[model samples]
Target: MEKKSIQNTLLMGFIEDIKLRYKTGNIVEKFIFINIGVFIASLLFKVIFGLYKTNGDFIFNWFALEHNFSTLITKPWSIISYGFLHAGFIHILFNMIALYYIGNLFIQYFTQKQLVQFYVLGTFFGGLLFMLSNSYFPLFEGTRPHLVGASAGISAIFIGLTTYMPNYQLQIRFIGFVKLWHLAAIWIGLDVIGLVGSNAGGHFSHLGGALFGFLYVNQAANTKLNIWDKLSGIFTSRKKPLHTVYKSSKKTAPKSKNTDLTQQQIDGILDKISKSGYDSLTKSEKEFLFKQGKK
Candidate 1:
């Protein structure tokens, strides 16, 4: 009875620890936890099916993105759902690793909501391209393949970050420091070369996600053409301005002087980070950027 009680206590403690981590973790950590949880659940289902000598893959059948347009119409949720599913341990392992690193870096610059948008939209675009390629391309003719994995969403985040900070340097253990865009180019090149391979559909989906990431970053880089602002304007109520009242120069002078940081200063700091990496910033610059990120 004592041994059983101890085991129960340990299990409860472990579960509570996980809950605590999930609650306080950043967006990247939360995503990694979710992918791991989903993967474990999928493995459990597979084992149960195997135990019963059942050949049916109920989970993948319903959640994985189908190649056929008709099947997709019936199971629209699969478009985004497929990104959360994985075919094997090795598949999810590498994907989650990539997502963890890239996503953490992404979150340092962008908001959590923007990361979610990139992931979901990237997955949607990837699934769409997968189905379209299967439908129109001669290469995919007479073959039906379902897509699964978080690679598409990860690719979106990866490519999007690369587009924003192309010169950013990432130190690889054995490879030294490599430019972000260099890695992104190689990533896309590999997918392009994989089009004729067995996992052609997967490659197509990756490219689709990368394309969205690239386009999104490019569009967002232009502040005047921000899509988010335009979309928000549609839902936001506007009212005509009242007559402007001039403030005394004497009162405004001290207020302007009190503002230590300006938009131009922030822009210059961002440009420095882009060219020389975040570590290039001095203590004060880093602190400023960190404080700005919090706001």
Candidate 2:
């Protein structure tokens, strides 16, 4: 009975550790969860309302500006909120997948705060472009369309990360290794090509998001806070000192003992290295493993 109890306790502990790791894994995971949650909610709503259209009409009809052009003048928030609501499962899935790859690369170097800023700003600009294109373009003059999906935000992250690390490379299944900039070029090229065909609104929004992403990286490198940072500061208190140090009379103790990675964490890292190459390890992992090797 005692042995069984010990085994059960160990299993429970392992499960709890996994839960924590997943919860705090990385920015990519968080973005995926948010997108999935929103997709599910939209799906439920659509089912309840019996709205099953897919030609981007439903998005414009309900959440976006329909024939009632007067309503848009009063409710401008629709432009932003519309992006979160998707047309179907496949739509959300593809955008979320793109977001995961792009966002992971972004948060690898940037702080979570910066990641959120880029995403929101990109989405705003993307929506703005969509609105402007619809309003001004002679072809789309009569049609007021609605834009949806995380594509704009995802595109921004992609562009931002590629700009920051232009030479970064990834291994493709068919192509062994390819530079990040080339990949970004291909992505943008597709959007440009798509512009000449159907889904012009989505393509135009992609351009807007891409522009914001490019400008953001350049501005950030020069030490200028982008609009998102300034906007966030409005709600947060500014009186607090930017940096603080805590002091105690007792000798400051080394944190190494308490900070050592657990056996499970070490195993997980090793497993990842086995599946992917050692290069797959992020900077933090490489440092941790290097320290462990020395010890």
lDDT for each residue of candidate 2 in 256-286, tens digit (9 for 90 to 100): 6444444446657765653454578999988
Please give each candidate's TM-score. 0.84, 0.65
Instruction: Check candidate 1 and list the clashing pairs.
Output: none
Number of clashing pairs per prediction, in order: 0, 0
Clashing pairs for model 2 are none
- The worst-scoring run of ten residues by lDDT in candidate 1 lies at 240-249
RMSD vs true structure, all candidates: 6.9, 11.8
Model 1 error, position 14 (Å): 1.4
lDDT of each: 0.81, 0.67
Looking at candidate 1, what is the lDDT of residue 207? 94
The list of candidate 1 runs beyond 4 A from truth reads 221-264, 288-295
